[model samples]
Target: MFLTVTLNAALDITYRVPRLRAHSTHRVQEVDERPGGKGVNVARVLAALGKDVTVTGFAGGATGAALRNLLAADQRERPNHARLTDAFVPISGTTRRTVAVVDASSGDTTQLNEPGPAISPAEWQAFTTAYAGLLPRTTAVALCGSLPPGVPVGAYAELVRAARAADVPVLLDTSGEALRRGIAARPDLVKPNGDELAQLTGVTVPLRAARDARRRGAAAVVASLGAEGLLAATADGAWRAAPPQTIAGNPTGAGDSAVAGLLSGLADGLDWPARLSRAVALSAATVAAPAAGEFDPSTYAAVLDRVEVAPQPHAA
Candidate 1:
């Protein structure tokens, strides 16, 4: 089974408004709520693609309960035989919530995120134990999103180590210090956006940045260049994958979809080129979807065949 870790799970709310202006009161045309966080988003995409996936992290309080209920409801609503397990560890503090304000006029998304609850020492220990216990069952594990308060920046590093110990590949997706520490653990793969890549490697050139990141101990570095494409540098080789054309929609969770594609492809034993093709196509499909963590299958199918995967020269 594919496993995803969201240290700070959240109840995500998406608000669609005709337009958003500063200090202007406007009525929201639509409202949608569900469980979210980078890992949960990835799991949603995996489940949609008919992959066996489980999401684990910490959840507490009323919002946490509500999120779990929503997850169970989502699982029940699926017609496919794919399974999605909710394995979140219970905590004492209330889980946080995030809001995505989508401006219908321009399709721009404004995100308001809340920092997750502070984890106590005992709660942290419980999460580690739970994570280690799940490692053996995971074919691959994705460590995603920002660390909750009271959790160390090196948490993902430790999680990566545990997964490695269990002989499971790990996909690390986070930014800033957490990412820096996690890369040192030499995760199987690391996906960072252009800005994060620049911050990590101090290079704006995608290929050079990816190479630098790989040298820092990540087995591979996949840099998400928004509408440009995805640049992947791995031991097998390097390649840049992009869709035939970029479609416009809500791009809120596109990165998570890309992560899902790469992980599912890896679990399926796809090569670097084919894996990147799937990742790029899934990312485009997610951009065309109505909400975060959802992708249009029609778009995915159409783009999958059209994705361009060009080999890139290895930088010395």
Candidate 2:
């Protein structure tokens, strides 16, 4: 089973509007609410792909309760996708929420996110204790999303070390200091977007940045370059995977879907080229889905072969 960790879980809210303006009143045509956060989003995509996945993190208050309810609802609605289990740590504070405003006219999406609640020392201990118990069962663990207010910046590093000690493959999919420290822990894989890669390694080029990140103790680095596709650097080799064409929709959780693809492929022992093809195809299909963390099934099957995986110019 794959495990996804989200320290700051959230209720994802997506709003559909005719058009978005800088400062104007507009009525939203529709709204979608789902359990979200980086790890939760990754788990959602993994489950949709028929992977047995468990999501663990912080959840509390009414929002947290509602999020769990929605997760249960998802299991009931799609039993064949995969089994999604909730193992979140309960906190006294309310979980956070993220808002995505999509302009149907231009097919553009705007996001407004709130910083999650600050966790307590006791809460952290409780989470770590439970996390230790879950490590052995995880084939691969995804340490995803932002660190909550009270959590340490080195939280992901701690988790990575624990997973390493257990000989379990772990993937770090966070940004900022968490990512920097997590990379130092020598995870099996690190998936970062171009900007995050640049920020961590100070390299402007995606390929060079991914290589630099790999040098910083990560076994491999997959840099997500939005529509340009994924640039991956591994011990085996480096490759750039791109979709046939950019499908415009909601790119909200495209990165998460890519993570799902990579983890699933890794579990299946697929080569880097095949793995990246799945990542790029899943990302493009996610863009075609109307909501964040969901992929269009038909779009994914059609785009699978169109994804192009080519070697990086400087890397053999």
Candidate 3:
């Protein structure tokens, strides 16, 4: 089973406004609230793809309860698919809420994320214990998202160590100090967007510079290039997976969907090229959908044939 760890869980709230203008009173046409955090998003995608996935990390307070309830409802709604293993640990603080304002006219989204709850030392201990207990059952672990208050920057690195101890591969996805520290743990895979990749490597070049990041410790690096698709580099070789064309829709969670595709491919024993193709296809499908992280299976299948994967030279 795939295990996903979201250190800072959240209740994601998305609002649709006709035309978003700063400091203007706008009427929201639509609003949606769901369990969120990068790992949770990945798990949802994996589950939708008929994979057995379990999500674990820190959750607490009323918001946390609501998040769990929403997950339970989703599971019940899709009983024929994979199930969520009970692994989430409850803390004393309430989970965070992130707001995304989607402009209807232009389809652009502006995100406002909360700092998340302050985790106590005791809560951290519980979270760690929960994660350790599930390591044996996990075929692969995805450590995602930012570190909450009171959580150290190296928190993901510690989880990577636990996954390594259990002989399970880990996929680390985050940014800033968390990404910097997590890479030091030498995760099996790390997915960062072009901007985040540049931030981590301190180089403005695209795929060429991404290779430099892989040499630092990540066994492989999958850099998301938005409309251009993904650039992946591993010890064996490097490849670029680009979609046939760009589709206009919500771009939110596209990277997370790509991570899910990569993890699903890895769990299924797919080769690097095929994995990159799947990641590209899924991400494109997600962008074609109206909701964030939601992808149409038909669109994904159609895009699969169009994704181009070609080898790239290793940086000297």
lDDT of 1 at 206: 85
Top-TM-score candidate index: 1
TM-score of each: 0.97, 0.96, 0.96
Q: So what's the TM-score on candidate 2? A: 0.96
Q: TM-score of the candidate numbered 3?
A: 0.96
Task: Report the error of model 1 at residue 104, Å.
Answer: 3.4
Per-residue lDDT tens digits for candidate 1, residues 150-200, read 998899889988888899999999999999999999999999999999999
Q: Give Cα distance to truth, residue 10, candidate 3, Å.
A: 0.9
2 against 3, candidate with superior lDDT: 2
Task: List the candidate 1 regions with Cα displacement exceeding 4 Å.
Answer: none
- Candidate 2 lDDT over 50-105, as tens digits, reads 89999999999999999999999999999788999999999999999999998999
Q: What pairs collide in candidate 3?
A: none
lDDT, residue 94, candidate 1: 93
Candidate with the larger TM-score of 1 and 3: 1
List runs of model 2 lying over 4 Å from the truth: 19-27, 313-316
| Tens-digit lDDT track of model 3 for 225-296 | 999889988988888999988877777789999999999999899999999999999998898886787887
- How badly does each model clash, as a count of residue pairs? 0, 0, 0
